[model samples]
Target chain A: MSTAAIAALTAILLVGIASTVIGIVGHRARRTSDFLVASRNVGAGANAGAISGEYLSAASFLGIAGLVLSDGVDALWYPVGFTAGYLSLLLFVAAPLRRSGAYTVPDFAEVRLRSRGLRLVCTAFVLVIGWLYLLPQLQGAGLTVATVTGLPAWTGELGAGIVIVLSVMFGGMRSATFVQAFQYWLKLTAVTLPVIVALVYFLGSGHTYDRPAPPSFPERTTVDVHTGVTLQAGQDVTFTAAGRIDGRDVAPTEPQTWTAGSRHVVGEGTDLTFPAGSAVPVVAGGPVADDEWLLPLSGADPHQLLGIYSLIIATFLGTMGLPHVLVRFYTNPDGRAARRSAVYVLAMIGVFYLLVTLLGALSRFYTPQLLVGGQTDAAVLLLPTAVLGSGTAGAVLGGIVAAGAWAAFLSTSSGLVVSLAGVLSTDVLRGKRLSNFRFATVLAGAAPVALALGVTQLDFTETVALAFAVAASTFCPLLVLGVWWRGLTAKGAIAGVLAGGILAAGAVGVSLAGIAGTGVLGVLLYRPAIVSVPVAFATMIVVSVLTARERPTDVDAVMLRLHAPERLGLSRDAVSGRDRAELDEPAPDERAAGPA
Target chain B: MSTIEERRADTGTVYERVQAGPEFADLRRRLRRFVFPMSAAFLVWYLAYVLLASYAPEFMATKVAGNINVGIVVGLLQFVSTFAITTVYVRFANRHIDPAAERIRQQIEGPAR
Candidate 1:
């Protein structure tokens, strides 16, 4: 039939295939370990693939393309921060957290701090991060589907939410692992194949690429583009069909034609436009400009130094706190295996990022027309179609890309839903049955779906970044201190986590409530990580020092477990909670057990 | 849950039939040395990527592909390098580390020949 029908069928078929695959794998691997950590038996290749799958979410694949297409060079930070964040995961948190043998972040908190209260606090952070991260993925799905099929945006998002929830409910982590790993290759193939084919098509077409035109009014003689522009978010703005400028009709058809400093004056009542090729500078108002919320602090003003750095810190520090991401480490056989897994994940994440940048840049160059609707989310598909010609080959390539996008979202979302369910069941509904855990999964999945549905009005990037900031502020510091320092007390952890999480989440809530966007409150409210991370770190350290009496005596044992890989094998089975305390210090039991 | 606990306790009796073998401690020491430093180095390398990405964006944005750019190259390579590292890690672990750890564990806890 039509393009919309083709796109719709492609989206549904991809999700269906993915869900079926996960269900089959998850059903076969049905065990606690499989459900939670993939049986701690995942191989390097598979784990690497799964890591790629989990890592390349809508943000990486779609958001980066949009950013790069919309803004030159500066948008590179998204991929950089995203890929590099894993490095932070490798160094400060990986091995030690893994060595603790905890299945989730809250589990680590409990083991490190020896307090159930701390576990609950960490559990809260995990849920927050999961939901925050979930929102963007959902929003992204909406944008992608709506662009591809001309369907209502919510239709795509809600459908995605349902599929992801079903996948998680059916398979849990074990299945998600296989699905994610498989999806990575699928994603790579989808993105790269299209790029290669499209490149060939463009070159084969015999058109010498034109140099970008001078920034000015579009050539008045070119096809009139004066139709009222409708933003994907459903906002509208009117523009003159053609403007008479310098003795000819100038229509702003191509961005490449814009000069460095050209400006456009809309009609008396109309708004403004950058020169055709000028940075699509996101002004403070209008549909596109609203991403200022995403930028948070224009710390460098036209430069975004603080906002960029804040994002960097968030992604770098934030990875440690991501529950689903962290839970994957536990599936490795031991602490050393966990560390190796992190390294592998980092490498895989890095490679896919290169492709993401290409896609982003190509969208602006090849599909500048789509930029009007901020169709960067659909660039991977649109660019290929534009280059390959709207034919069967293009449709096939588009379908493959669509499948990758679905897989990326489904895998990560399933992972999140599973982890959220696990934590909530164990920590919130302690002593609950398996059914209760499943119920938690439904609850956890549904909340984000509701939030995603409600907040369809906001910019996708900003919602996602707020999630990252909260993750960075609340859980990142908690994990860093919990793993590295001996002085991290249960009371301290509880206090620090609550303080950091509350402050950050509160700031986000206040900002979302339409408070004035001017001074100190705005900065703190918008970019809470700069404020919250340090506060969490300081609070943990200070509180721990004050509450040393409650400290575990096995500091030395814990250190050995964390650092010494020698006695790490089966002896770990001998290590008890009390032994952990003894490891941390010269306990009375050290004398009782005598020398090894 | 109780049955699983009981079965686990029954399994504990088997530990008595096993004895630590002569090669166990030495193998443990060797495996520990190999795995620890290798893992530590990779961890350091991984951390360096993050530090570079976070603190050094300007350097990253330099080009590698036509316009693909170094930042993009480095970012994508992160995923590739991680897999390569992981494959090597697993090969090393299976060949050098796991067999040793298993040998040591079996000597201490597995039934004796």
Candidate 2:
């Protein structure tokens, strides 16, 4: 077996063992509270780590570097937007959300709006967003394993899906939290160590980026195409080939010349050699030339400005509505703790993203071959091997990064599955038994895995961004209005959610169906948040004002519960002095009366 | 609707008492004061950055320091400003919001003893 395969297998095994160990350690989570929100006793630091772990999905770990390598300086917006999302959460949503004491977004919706119908609608959107987010993670796992092990993609997806399902089923929120927190540190160390070594090597090698030109192969390099790809050659080049070119089988005995300024189809298992100082070919639809790559909004597309603005809007407003992320805030002991944890999350995610952006920039200088192979997502996984070659150091660093990627997939997918299962078991199934939760876990994980196995065309970052846009359109309006504005009647909420959810989901569907043509309309469909979010908000406000009589009479009480700090003692289950004493001691009768 | 009203009535006295109190009003004012202005400022700043990066690429690409352009510097400052805002808000909450909220809690709970 190749070193890459061995390294990748070791990484997967280590992740599996780590998760199992954590599940065993946190095996005592029997109550529904433990299952759903870890008994709401988590500290700020640990919760922050877990939140960071789950938040940095495969998109952040692999896709960001890939985007930076492929798309240029404009891609920096992704990391910036992602980390800045927590700032919005910290400022607006964190404390109030925790103080509201809702276990899920749907629960919050039901409580704040006092409507079961709106709760159900919120639940459906939660599932949609969770599954949408899960798709890229599963697909990214497939891509990572394929890049590292040369194995077929489906194996990795299935492996990640099964592991996440088992772990979530075994210990629910408690185990998932512990495992995710540990994975955060593991991912940090993995990326940090390899980049440090690479940086040292780079400084010693004394390579400079002083030239004003696009990237070229520093030495003769041969790239094996594991899947068929069409290459857009820039200049005439003759290279040795050992596989099918343009649907004709080519023997390993002879060399072939690829003409410049035309597209050529290279079949699977082809090894193409490019001599030193040759410019790398573009991957058909991917970015071109360093000038366009280095400059923001200059990438041969007219809709670039619209795309950037929409992306910013979606990511900026969307994070508070992510089901997995919102549920993590519930694990905090109180509103103050929740706010503190958000602070820590901002710090941790900020430092990690800085390192990730650096890795993306370095990948350009080190692994431009990924850009040519149309596998820029492998830029992170391939950097160690590219710089250090296949020696002991390379294999070890490669194994570490591979493990980090697995942890990314595992933590994120587990968080999503846990949130999905909680919503299903609690709301849809109306069965809170552990058995029902486990069953929901299986169901929640199955659809995404099946979809991931069949679909392979979407970019990882773009898929995740679509989920964000939908969430921004749907729940951002709901939460902002429900929390701050007393005029948000139930009828208005339903109209808003339906309008936003349908429009955004339809845009995604159109884009997915490949029916969107390249122009303003196409760009709007591709990035719908700019238009759809305002439409949802406006529809909600207008409908609410028209149906003002339908507003809940208890809006004052619900708003008090949400905005009042924990120190306010205004929570629904507030105990009298005697009851507080009984609760503290937990006598037999008190134990019996405790939450089920 | 009847069931909802019954549930509301169960907690009605406490909600009414809290809402009637001055401390609760003070707490609301303090929180709104901190969040409203902060949120507006941050949104405006973020939108400006996005618009500039999209439409004013030449400005964003101008060199700020050696090997660092204005865009990269501004991007890094985004992180810095986030941390700064978080620190300031945490301090603000601890000093102003928490004490007022604590007073209201004591009043609603009718004395810790």
Once fitted onto the true fold, the runs of candidate 2 whose alpha carbons sit more than 4 angstroms away are A222-272, A284-287, A513-516, A567-569, A572-596, B1-14, B20-22, B64-66
lDDT of 2 by residue, B1-113 (tens): 24334545576877877877777788878888988898788778777777887769889878765446777777778778878888889889988987777776666555555
lDDT string, candidate 1, A206-287, tens digits: 4321222211122121222222232221122223334543234555462223233333322222223433333332222222
Predicted complex 2: CAPRI docking category: acceptable
The DockQ figures for the candidates are 0.11, 0.41
Instruction: lDDT for model 2, please.
Output: 0.80
Docking quality of model 1: it rates as incorrect
Q: Which interface RMSD values do the candidates have, in the order shown?
A: 8.8, 4.5
CA shift at A62, candidate 2, in angstroms? 0.6
